[model samples]
Target: MTRALYSLCGADERHFFSPHCWKAVMALAHKGLDFEEVPTTYSRIVDIGGGFSKTVPVLDDNGRLISDSFDIALYLEDTYPDRPSLFGGEGGKALSRLVEGYSQMMIHPAIMRIALLDIHSILDEGDKAYFRASRESRLGKPLEDFAAGREAEREAFAAKLEPMRHMLRFQPFIGGESPLFADYIVFGALQWLRIAAGLAMLAPDDPVMAWFERCLDLHESRGRTVTAA
Candidate 1:
């Protein structure tokens, strides 16, 4: 009865980039869990089963099925409370929600804009048609047309993270002292860019860059284990 985490990967099974999936990965890592990685693509989620989920990061803990990264995190915390805590405590748990919202509201879009084309470039041929059709509908244009102006997007991303920059200047992590679910929340976004675009989105001197590196090195190179395929 081993555990398995279904991760969303690109054309190459090695390039697992879904930000939400990264959250689950880090959460499992923080809890000291050993699980097999099950790579998935957009068209393959249904393979998980009906009423369970049609998304990556679906936890197959032995026989149980859990979907949604946040829900999966909570499930892991509840199921393995004895392990190192992912949330830290009730207080950290609550603040992590704020981090999650901030990451989604401010950071996710910027990464997508800068790396959308990069992401598209890595998709397998099987996924390309579906990816293009679905994404283009929301973007109202071809992805190629949408992914222009990396410089402006990078500048915008930097400005959007000013608060995080100021915070990191004093604290080593968003969770203060050590990484917590809060750190995982934002780290997931950074992981997304790293896997999708493989682009250095930050300046060498930025505190956020330092934190990102620390995240990469966390949990015995957990973040770095998967390459952008």
Candidate 2:
């Protein structure tokens, strides 16, 4: 039986980057796992999840169900120890935790607001309509109103980047030599924000930008492929 990885289709266009999905996909790519990608909408997640919380990046390995991106990464690391190390080592593990915490607690929400502001320009009319309708149906407010209220909060988030920039060295990757789970997590969260807000161009000389490029180069060299699913 083949393993299956479920993700939101058109996530990139939707101005949504499921970090969980990215973690799983990166892990699978690193491990050379032969898994099938299953695409579904956010609505479908609730309908098919049997009353569980609706979330993308759910995985089915044979008959076992695994949810959450970090859990999936850990599961894969344990299941395939011979593959490249995502946590790197003790230092990598600690850094991973720090990166994950920052991404979850600080970066994601702010980036989301920025993305919401530019959603129309990034996505086509149908996708924009679908997303707006979905949000209204789920949250009972217009996307524009929501984004407007959160603009200040999002602007504050850019300050958090200062520490990240200071922490980064002239190394090619986050962990100094190779790209780790932290790199991918940070990349996934910030990359979409950068693209949607055009903030990356503002930091052309920053180490974080160089690190980001290195991450892409490393993944490409490893034949990491991302499809629509």
Candidate 3:
């Protein structure tokens, strides 16, 4: 049987709001695939059923372990070639690459900062301590020192928004008329800003925001299903 395992907490609002996971889920739904979700704690992720890295969105397809969200998305596209194309055609593929690259380069860092803002609330005290200690060990600087750079980070993020806004204004979706991998990539980054920072990528009048609303509508219509073992 073809089986997939997703490691995620059942009650995490942030994980539910995660665009990365959402995109993967959407792809699975789009392909009409049957999969299982494995509810996991943060620490147990690295060693759930043997020695493995603790990543929440890990996909184990009949014992072949695949980690990382982007990799998982690509795997799905390759595994189920008969499904609707996520990359669209050559122009769409090119657009997807540009959108993914821009999102990773310009948007992800800011989203990371927004997530870290309330990290203490989400993680246990022990986990928080361990996270800080690990960072300190690697960087030789305190977490507080690293966190103090938030203002500059936000400003840098804001500066990049203009160019993104310009690019998105012309197209209904990042990859053109229809949704594609590029749309999902950018949506994942934007989802972080919306949920983590309570921010919007564009003004209310912007066409990009309208596209986002349309994406959300499509997401809601697809439905989410969770099964028990």
Predicted model with the maximum TM-score: 1
The sequence of per-residue lDDT tens digits that candidate 3 reaches over residues 1-229 is 7676564442352234445665666666556777865555455566754755556577778888777677776787888888877776667656666677788877876666545544434454555576667657875777666667766776566566666568676877665677777677776666545654555434677555666666665645542232111
Q: Assess the local accuracy of residue 29 in candidate 3 as a C-alpha lDDT between 0 and 100.
A: 58
Candidate 2: regions farther than 4 A off: 11-16, 47-53, 117-141, 149-158, 194-201, 221-229
Candidate 1 residue pairs in backbone clash:
11-124, 15-229
Ranking by lDDT: 1, 2, 3
lDDT for model 3, please: 0.62
Using lDDT as the yardstick, the better of models 2 and 3 is: 2
User: Taking the tens digit of each residue's C-alpha lDDT, what string does model 2 give over 69-167?
Assistant: 787878877887898887876777766887889887787777766667564455545556777887767757777777775657665765766656776
Worst lDDT run of 10 residues, candidate 2, spans: 220-229
TM-score of 2: 0.75
True-vs-predicted CA distance for residue 106, candidate 1, Å: 0.5
lDDT per model, in order?
Answer: 0.85, 0.66, 0.62
CA RMSD, predictions in order:
1.6, 4.3, 4.7
TM-score of 1: 0.94
